[model samples]
Target: MLKEILVHCGHSFCKQCIQKALGAQQQSKTPYSCPMCKLQLGPILELQKNFQLCSIVEAFLASTSKGQQQPGRLSRGRRAEKGVWG
Candidate 1:
């Protein structure tokens, strides 16, 4: 059976392929290029998706949108201490 993971390019790659690419990246200083397209994968961390099996398009959007949010951002202050600003 072929175990697969989602690629940043909205494509499916076998788990073996992903591991191989990551190993190549770790062994060498250069980024690992995609086997099929030869596109450099910046970071293996960038390749891992927040959602498993999610389409790359959706995953990319989600990653860009809220990945940088501060933890407890809105809950930092009590309702009585601050009024609604936005």
Candidate 2:
């Protein structure tokens, strides 16, 4: 998702969605618009990748996966049974 993030008129969208929107625009012969702000994006090729947001998302996901893989953490039910706040 973050790997191919695209930005248009200060809004971000995934690459796949942008591609689909571009295709639709092409068929309609209309310009692409930002999904969030509805601002016109002149050209699909001109769309820029938001590398900073991508990097942050990647890091957050990596940390989340690592946390899930660790076996030391107790489940919510078990913690509650042990008198630990759930």
Candidate 3:
């Protein structure tokens, strides 16, 4: 996850994953549960942005290829985004 979103549970997830989860909900006000620990998260809309994790990741990715899941090379195809960096 490049552009990360920090949850109230102190867990970090990618922006896309949270969006997908929220999209699957029946209504906008539905609370999202944490996938890892099942904590009840509030509405995604109230989620705060302006987190600094993006800059850290971008710098790491630029400094080395370590950010990629595949060691020493790029992934052959775009993999699904999860809570953590691939």
Report the lDDT tens digits of candidate 3 across residue range 1-86.
45688777777778887667767763665567766677887654455553787778777787657554546554434343332335
TM match of model 2 to true structure: 0.65
Superposed Cα deviation of residue 35, candidate 3 (Å): 1.8
The CA lDDT of each predicted structure is: 0.62, 0.73, 0.64
lDDT of 2 by residue, 48-71 (tens): 787888888888789777765347
lDDT of 1 at 35: 66
Summing lDDT over every window of 10 consecutive residues in candidate 2, give the lowest-scoring window: 1-10
Model 3 RMSD in Å is 7.4
As a whole number from 0 to 100, the lDDT of residue 78 in candidate 2 is 72
Deviating ranges (above 4 Å) for candidate 2? 1-4, 68-86
Ranking under TM-score, best-scoring first? 2, 3, 1
